[model samples]
Target: MERKHKRLATRRAAGVAGVVFAVLTAAAITLVRTALPGGGDDVTLDAGQRGGLRTALELVPFAGIAFLWFMGALREQGGRAEDRFVATVFLGSGVVFVATLFGAAAAAGTVLGDGTQDSTFGSHFAYALLTTYAMRMAAVFIIATSTIGRRLGALPRPLVAIGYLAGLTLLVAGSGVPWSEMVFPAWALLLSLNILWGRPPAAAPRTAPA
Candidate 1:
């Protein structure tokens, strides 16, 4: 009984962490997009824009930290039913996604500090790191997570399908696709909500190793 309660408590914490990770990441991305011009045209950001960028930079580190905690919680929930190969892939991709995301944010911060509209390389490079590399890793991580959830009966079939679709969209969509990156956070939001809503019962059995 004590172990069961402990497990439930852990799941609740993880679920909340996942929601926080999604919201923080989404807000940071939105702030950056709103602050910087979307096109290739070089334009100087006004005071408001600079303020937005600064806020975004500040949010990113916290988002990354929350995501790591969310990952730990997710894996704990999965327990021994998780396949070694897929679990490894999921963990690796998640870590890489966070690293690339931070790198992109740092690059963007550098560009913001320089305030050089003519030097667009940093801006372009940061977007590439985010959309191309980070999101691709995110796609893989999502797919692996969905698979694990399905195997463990942790997620519903509909949610699993949505996960697959979201992953595919992230994998196929390029940087030019407007709001494409939003799918990741949206999926995370839904998943977190579901986890919170259908929390494990206090008497539920502890997960057993395969």
Candidate 2:
């Protein structure tokens, strides 16, 4: 009973951490899209605003990566599958996400503020967008795919469904809306549900491992 309680406590902590980081990830996405200057009035960002956006945007991907790593770790510790394939995809995309953010930050250092922008400036901006937001989107794709292939339980059914729905919605439509930023938080909510309160493991049979 005590061991079970301790396991539950650990899952709770991991869920909380995942939620916190997911919110951070969402906020950072908002910052990148809305705070930066450039593009049309629809997406305009000034030079200084871009700098600030660059700094904030750089941190978000890492937070998300950490969030995944934490959840995977927790699942492993709790005697879940650990799903090496999922972990590998998560790790690869996460690295690209984080590395690109820092790259943007580095770019911010050299590029001084100005009202107008250069064409090459657009290239760097594109890089940031592709690496950070684009790859985050990819993470959603991977998660959705794995969820479909995995063996899930009844109580957790809604979570997997929500994840698939939200991920697909974001992949298709979320990027267009100004408030598309909320997608990360939605994902975080699903992940937390799966981690903290998903179906309990069935009793182990008396037979030993084959």
Candidate 3:
């Protein structure tokens, strides 16, 4: 009974962290996109736009921290029955996503510090890292997470399907499609809501190792 209660508490914490991460990330992305559309060096930011960008950059670190908590809690929920290979992928991708997110934010901060808008490389680099590399990592994380959830019977089929679709979209079109980066946070929000309010599924029996 104590064990079950502990698990429930962990689940609640994970759900809350996931929700916080999703909201903060989405808001940061929106603010950054609005202030520095297309990451073009030719674009000049007014005082208000710079303030918004600064606010967005400040939010990134907190979002990353929440994401780490969400990832750790989800892994704990998987327990000893999780496939080692898939779990490694899930963990690796999530860590890389957070690292890249921070790197991108740092680069954007450099761009913001340049009052003359001469840091074209910083602007482009940040944009590429965020939209291309970080998003691809996020895609991998989502795919691995969905696979684990499906194997463990924790996620519904429809939600798993949506995860796959969202993962593929991020993998293939993240850099090329404008505003496609929003998909990751949107999916996170949905997953968090499900974790918080949906009925928990029974765990599937673990398969014997080959």
For this target, which candidate reaches the highest TM-score against the unseen true structure? 3
Best-to-worst order by TM-score is 3, 1, 2
lDDT of each: 0.83, 0.55, 0.90
Model 2 TM-score on a 0 to 1 scale: 0.63
Clash pairs, candidate 3, are none
Residues 1-210, candidate 2: write the lDDT tens digits. Answer: 996676567767767777777767666655654554332222344676666666665666566576666555445442444356665565565455555545554454333334345534743565445444754555464463336334433225556666666666656653355455466566675666676776555422344578
Over the stretch 23-114, how does candidate 1's per-residue lDDT look in tens digits? Answer: 99999888888877683234367888889878988999999999899999888887655789999999999999999999988878765655
* Comparison by lDDT, 2 against 3, better one: 3
Model 1's lDDT to the true fold?
A: 0.83
| Candidate 2 backbone collisions, by pair | 36-45, 37-45, 37-46, 38-45
What are the candidates' C-alpha RMSDs?
Answer: 2.5, 4.8, 2.2
Tens digits of per-residue lDDT, candidate 3, 4-40, equal: 7877888888899999999999999999998988664
Per-candidate TM equals 0.92, 0.63, 0.94
**TM-score, candidate number 3:** 0.94
